[model samples]
Target chain A: MKPIIKIQNLSKRYRLGGNGGARYATLRESLSGMMRAPLAILGRKGRASRPELWALKDINLEIMPGEVIGIIGSNGAGKSTLLKVISRVTEPTEGRVELYGRIGSLLEVGTGFHPELTGRENVYLNGAILGMKKEEIERKFNDIVRFAEVERFLDTPIKRYSSGMYVRLAFAVAAHLEPDVLLVDEVLSVGDMAFQKKCLQKISQMRSHSNAILIVSHNMIAVRAICEKVILLSQGQLAAAGRADEIVPLYEKLMLENVKTETVADEREEGMGIIRVKSVRLVNRAGTEARAFDTGESMKVVVEYEARQRAVSVVAYAAIRRPDGFICMGTSTRLEGVVLPPLEGPGVVELEISELLVIPGYYIMDVTFYDENFEFRTYFLGRKQISFQINSSLPSLDDKYGVFYQKHKWNIDDVNVNSPAHR
Target chain B: MGLTSNENVSALEPAVTKQTATITEASPIRHTSYQVPDNPLVVIAPTKSWVALNLGDLLTYRELLYFLIWRDVKVRYKQTALGAAWAIIQPLFTMLIFTLFFGRLAGISSEGIPYPIFAYAGLLPWTFFSNAISNGSSSLIGDSRLITKVYFPRMVIPIAAVGAGLVDFVIAFIILVGLMAYYGIGLSLNILMLPVLVLLLTLLATGVAMWMSALNLKYRDVRYALPFLIQLWMFASPIIYPASLVPERWKWALALNPLTGIIEGFRASLLGYRNFDWKTLTISAVITLIILIYSAYTFRRMEKGFADIV
Candidate 1:
């Protein structure tokens, strides 16, 4: 079988500095520089150094046609660099690659779109970037519009579309393009659940049609569900490969150990400021081994603080940061009906987050103890950013992919109920 | 640290974890991984290439080029206070300035035509070329978000900028014709030379825009210096004064600016005046083509670094 993709030893390097000053140069300066050009080339330190960081080095790889592979790695693992080289978005410093057929890449959403242009206009525009002709775009126009599900807004300028809408539309156009090979980055991480599922199904459909796909994703679940093989990149080189089941665990373990070994927030805020929240372990009413909080479970965020002040009528606030740098939930004792008592030295405060409406995902908590008048406060009262995770089986499993997971029960209706089973 | 459920992806059965199972079977996930080809795949290569004219492939991507041009045109005046009228307003206002300052105040000759008409004529191609060069050159940096992410011809940016100025040029040309009618000047048959001038302006703009666009990707200082450079270039050309007034001895030297000849030729073509100096026009045309070709070569050489350094 003819290998559809190949990468030999590839490298990329860059020179830093030299981005200032005016463009004035007299003929004398020019002549002198021209004269010194040969001498400058011979100077030892004048060397830019193949300064030699190979984004990819000796990375000779071959893949059979129609085989889906997951390129997985931690950040700076050269995954994107490899993708960049393979996609021909950036040329390799060394090595050559040959493709028997046309290739389309979805490395970013709205890659070549003019935001002022309408979706219909951008479809033809972006299609042309993928090397499709006008007739080819027109033939697939309806399919593209239908798949993106922005048919009603097709005439509207894409700038008005939400980032989610942009990705969906862009990905839909890429999917319908029908290139022999597709390179997709973590673009599916956008959009709601149903849309993501639609994309996954569409990708599978593409596979059935014999279009090879390479995906880079941190979502191991998605990788396991779709990828036939997994190659893990570590520090610009292949760390592990061959199987997803084997490689993913090692990757996860590696990440988990990194998480435990380093308190990232502590390191980030070390010199900034430091105050302390003595304790943060939350507890329920029963307190009978309540390891996790359920949706609607009455919970207490126990905060004990040691402030460096008299702390009169002290106020305390807690906030949750979602993994994607979004604020999930936050509230202060002042916002609630609590006027804190004056604090002379140390204090313990129990704030009830009435109904934990958050869904399953990693959440980090930041606490601050302040004076009642909201005077200047130290960072996190010293404890820094503590971490937590939320899980709600019903909403997390069904509703959507955002921070909140509100409790709303549903009644099921079976079309075949009268046909016997449920009846 | 306790979220070990993800461990199922690596270890099959926990019972065999201590035994360290040598996983033989590849992961059953059905993803198709494309090989990165023996030669770099032409996947995200900018649709535009400056290496060779690549006009065949360009013709193939004509719709993209068309839409990009159209997009730039729309975006230019999308929410402007005067909308499409700004096109006419920009060149018309500049012509007024040149007429007042250079013609009226400084006492410059118009080669026997009305000052406004001759100045406007000079401003037409000059504005088109300058605007094209100015905007086209900085276009790559202006849309760094787009350039860094997607793989489209980087040349399209400067090309679009130049293309967008054509709309303004057309609008300004309409005004020029109306002015010509008002001034009672007859159209010379030499107007046949107008198309060639326009093409020359485009090639020159695209070429210089290529250099600026590519350079601007790395050094944004070019953007700041561009307007000043254009101001100096305006004086260097014959936009306000007649090129003939630059002194017969210095005319050959002044013609080196390229736009001087193109602008003079444009003015002479539309107005019933002196037939354009074929020698100066020929010299300017060749120089414009050379600068264009050379800048394009330099731009091509510089373009590969755009994604990385840009």
Candidate 2:
């Protein structure tokens, strides 16, 4: 079968260190550079010379109809650049892309929304911006308002609407565009949790209509839930491409390997140069050391340390930091009102979690050993010494909405007796 | 990870292909195939030589163009207390100042018609031309978000900016009609050519705007320099003063500036103060067309870098 989209040897190069003083070379630079061009050329004859950075290189992929592909990579791995090139937002420096259908790109939410315009006006304006005709927008007007749930504030200027309302209306307009090929960036992270689920469902529904969807995101669970095929990029080249199950784990393992190396070499071990952490490992209930854990599973974190000084008060503290570099949770033995005994030459401490209800994503662990006196002075601070992954086995789990899942139950007590099914 | 769900797609793949194959055989137009000979296949290459305008693409996006213009016009008056009254208020006050300073104090000649109507007629087109150019010149830079994120004819941005100015021109033109009614200066068959003059002015303004907007994307100095350029251009045109004040031998030189011919043509056709100069209007139209084509070519050439530079 012929592919719906074909990309041939695409590449994009950018000038380095150019956007700071100006986006491009100033007139003065051109003049001076012109005068020194010949000398510079002669000086560079014996050396390899170029200041260009290739954001994408020799990438070739064919996408079929009714397929959803996830593009996963570390930061600056050209994932977004590949999307921009395919969306025609920017031109590739080399090669070509042949497309067979109408393309609708959602590089950002509320991309063309005007703050001064009413929400009703923005819906039409945004619809037009996405290549919807006037008649089409009019036909979808009621559906859009209903989906956004902003009927009461339709006439109000979008500037007055809350941020949540603004994103809801924006996504509603975009979702109804129904292009044959949908290119979505990391825009689903907006809105509330239930709304994010609605958007994911909307994207999947678009796929059932024989449309092709390409999504780029760092949220592994989002890609795992929606994508059939996955492409992994590393350093501006395709590292691997296959099914998501095959690629996501490889990508996760690759990321964990990089973090492990950094953890070993980095200067995160901070203290008075004594009683430093030797190793920290996470062991599941099955007694196997693992870097990843499933939600609702018990796990143990073991910290092994070497202490040169004896008879000194030391309390082990651990903190979990989200990807945005904020500490989400932290705990210490002293904080829990348990006094630790004096440290010896070598020791081990274990912090066990009954059930890891945390959401799916990568997280950094900061383990430190502080004095028992609750003073601000620290005996040792191990910063980013270990990292772990908490994945959800539940199919309904959404990682974009929040970092943790709180356990709760719902009760419905009152019901009118109409049929046995009501009970 | 939906590891097992992908098996369902692989299971459904062959049936889907067979379905598409039969549909393509039945109706080629309705089927999805880039291989169809008559269906144009768009190949987006990294680098290609600059081509002339893709008028078909621009035509298809005419609705978007309309919406953009509507958005500009709406946003211009959205938060303002006076709303669109500012459109009428602006030219009226400018005309009043010119009537006082240039007509009374400076004793400018209006030929046979009243000075107020003469000045009003010239200012009508002058205001439109200036506003269109100033707004159009910054249209691309001002809409950096849309330009960088979306794919459309870059010319549409400046064109819409010029189109939005037409709303204000129509509003101010009503005052020109009122002045003509009060003065009892009847219009003749020459008044029918008013649209042609408006078109010529639009082409001229669009030409300058295209050039300025493209330059603004690169240097950004164009943003600061544009207002001063428009001020200088306004004085050079014969809005407050008559073109007759220039010596006839140098009238050819005055005609070199397209606005001179356009403003003089408006005064003659709208107010009948002087005989229409077809030769001057013809020369202005030719110059306008030439500038339009040149600037359009330059704009298309520079558009590829707009997203990168902007």
Candidate 3:
């Protein structure tokens, strides 16, 4: 089968600096620039050789029909640029994209929605902008309104609606668009949880209709859930493409490594001259550094610090956080009433747990150091300082769902069928 | 030392984990090949030619153009106390001012027709032309969000702005009819040429608008310069005065301004005040066509840069 979308040697270059870098330039500035560099102006080039940034470089990809591909990347990784290029929102500096069948792009929800217009009017207007025919919009009008759940406010201008309502209406109009090839860019992270679920369901439904959907999103959970395949991009280049489960973990590990190196460099450069944190590590029972631990395994968090001068009554804190940024556990020496020795050149603080009860998933550890009065006179004021993973080896423990793994047993005492208190 | 005391740690754990699974369970991959109908395939690449007016795309996106025009017309009068009445009020009050200043005070000739109705007829087309150009000049900037987010024939935006002005033109045309009736002016065979004149006026406005709107996306100087340009252009046209008022040598120059013939054509057609000046009308048609073709090419050349700069 022919691919729904095929891109060849795609590249987009943006010139940096000078008036060219600005969105628009005034006539006076342009005139002066031309006068200052007549030869360059005649040549239709910048006065100096302008630096260029390639938003996308030499990208070749083919997406088959009925495939849902997730694009994952850090910020500035050409994800949105790729979508824009594919949708023809912006022309590429080089190369070409061939697309089969009708294409619809939802780079942003409510691309042409007017606040002054009523919700119903905006639906028609936005639908038209998304390439839906007038008859198409009219046919799906009720479905769009019902999905938005703004039936009562259909006649009211969207400016009067709450922000949630506005997003819902916008997304609803976008969701109703039926195209053989659909390109979406982070529009799923809109509205409340239930509405987001509805949108995900809508997207999965689109996938089942034999449409090719390309989604650029930072939400790992959403990408993992709906996409069978994932593409990882880094620095405007295709880094990897594989199955969703495999590529997502690889992307996460790359992100964690990047964070670790950046934080270590930051610590050396900005060490406040009072107390500096040298390293933070997670160790298992084998007395070796580890990033993965099974449920109920022994784990220790060790923090090493260097003090410039004698300081008395220092306090230390450690907190474990889930990938979703929820802090599972937080503890401090001050809260526990522990006193520390003074005049430390170098010292180590360890938090040991006999049983690491965290459920199987990725987690982050944050450490803080301060004076006994809670004044942060120490270095390393950062979040997500270290990240680790958890896995469950026990089948019984894997079935239960929660943040922490708890050991419990169930006892079944059979009540005799023939002797229910002689009832 | 171990810091695992229960008093020291804050466990903000919820008692119940409802586990409302939002992620759909991954089904086995099905290699279902979609049988795409013979829909038109689109190939996107960097423009190779200097001029690429994909006018067919305008036809394909005609519904979008209509919706955009509807949106403009719908939103223009919103929140105004007078609502659509402002459409009639703008040209009506402008005609009053022009009558007071250019007609009575300046003693400008109206070629034998009554000054009020004469000026009203000229103002009708002139108002639509100027508003279309002014609105079209900034239409792309105003829809910058749409430009950057969606793909359509970029020309549709300026065309829609020009199209939306027809609503006001039609509304103001009614007042022209009322003025003509009050002045005892009756329709003539020349009146049949009104649609042709209106078409020329629309073509001229759309051409200039497409050029200015595309330029405005890059320089923004068009925005600051447009209103002033419109005022000068109104004077250049035969709106408040007759084309014959100009010296003979300058009359040719006046004819060079396309509005000269189009405005005069409107008056001659509606009021039957004078024989149709076929030479000036022909000049107007040719110039309108030239501007339309030239501006379409320029707009096409600049189209690719719109989403990036906008």
- The most accurate candidate by DockQ is 3
Candidate 2, chain A: TM-score against the reference: 0.65
Q: Residue pairs in steric clash, candidate 2?
A: none
A1-423 per-residue lDDT for model 1 (tens digits): 567776556555444333243333234444765687787788843455424455666666776666678888888788888777776667666666666556778787667777788889889878876667788889878778877879899999887776567777888888776677778788767564577777776665565444467899877767877776788888778888876777776886676555545553331222112335666756765764243565556667777666555556556777776533345677777878678766656667776766667665455666666444322222123434566545554443422454465555444574322211111
List where candidate 2 sits over 4 angstroms from the true fold. A17-21, A24-50, A261-362, A365-423, B1-40
| Deviation (Å) of A373 in candidate 1 | 33
lDDT of 3 by residue, B77-152 (tens): 9999999998899899999999999899999988877888889988899989999999999999999999999999
Residue B145 deviation, candidate 1, in Å? 2.9
Cα deviation of B145 in candidate 3 (Å)?
0.6
Interface RMSD of 2: 7.0
> Residue-wise lDDT of candidate 1 within B96-168, one digit each (tens)?
8888888899888887788998888888888788888888877886777665555555666677788888888
Error of 2 at A105 (Å): 0.9
How much is B68 displaced in model 2, in angstroms? 0.5
Best by lDDT: 3
Worst ten in a row by lDDT for model 3 chain B: B12-21
Per-residue lDDT of model 2, residues A1-423, tens digit only:
566688999998876544464675445555776787888888974223536778999999998766678999999999988887877778889988988777888878887899899999999889998899999999979878887889999999988776778888888888777777788888777654577888886666556444678998887878878886899998899999988878987887777667655543232566664577888888898999987887667888888887777646667788776543345677889779877787777878889877776776677777887655423223243332567777775656654557677664445577433321112
